[model samples]
Target: MNKKRLGPCVTFFPQPTTLVSTIAADGEVNVMTASWAGIVSKTPPTMAVSLHAGRKSYDNVKQSGEFVVNMVPASLAVEADYCGV
Candidate 1:
């Protein structure tokens, strides 16, 4: 048998990529790729998504106080890549 060691890091395979859509104050729709999202509560059916302060969607969410999460399937890999960009 072979043995190897790796440093501490975050690693999760087959993560469900989501396109978080938010509406700006000016009624502009902004979408961004988010992989670090998950269910925060099952009873209330709530989810949590992390966003960078510099991201436009962050401000949009702050202003609108709402967002929609669209899950991306394997078939939409290309489109997901586009959204990620």
Candidate 2:
């Protein structure tokens, strides 16, 4: 077998996608498709999702300190893509 070195990078092929739903203090609901979410700890059963500061989801999470991470099923691929867009 042949091998080659590559530059520093992060890759999670076939990563599981998720729909993160959040509500603001004003009761405004928002849902965003996230591919950069995953379990960060096992003992504490913690998870993490990456969101930009300027995004509505980020604001909602920050304001309410609550969010739901829903797993994306194959049947909802279209809907998930729509949400991400």
Candidate 3:
């Protein structure tokens, strides 16, 4: 059997499409679609999500100190894609 090598990049497919919601210091709400997310803890029901440093959601989440992760169903793929883009 032969194995092929993959390049270094964020290529984890079949990832859960998630909508990350965050609030700003001034009570502004922001939502960001993220595919790089996973459960980090079970006892506290915590999750880990990766976001670009320059993104608004990242700053909002950092400032507000919390976020909400919503899983996207198949029926909402289009809307999810829009948010991700």
Question: Model 2: per-residue lDDT, tens digit, 1-85?
Answer: 7887777988567867699999988888888998788889999999988988888999888888889999888888887988872
Full ranking by lDDT: 2, 1, 3
Relative to the unseen true structure, what is the Cα RMSD of model 1? 1.9
lDDT of 2 at 31: 88
Q: For model 3, where is the 10-residue window of minimal lDDT?
A: 7-16
Q: Put down candidate 3 lDDT per residue, 1-85, tens digits, no spaces.
A: 8997887866756877789989889888888798689888999988889999999999987787889889988899888877653
For 5-65, candidate 1 gives per-residue lDDT tens digits of 6679877877787889999888888888987888889998988899998999889988889
Query: Against the hidden reference, what TM-scores do the models get?
Result: 0.82, 0.82, 0.77
Of the pair 2 and 3, which is ahead by TM-score? 2
lDDT of model 1 at position 66: 93
The candidate that wins on TM-score is 2
Q: Pick by lDDT: which candidate is best? A: 2
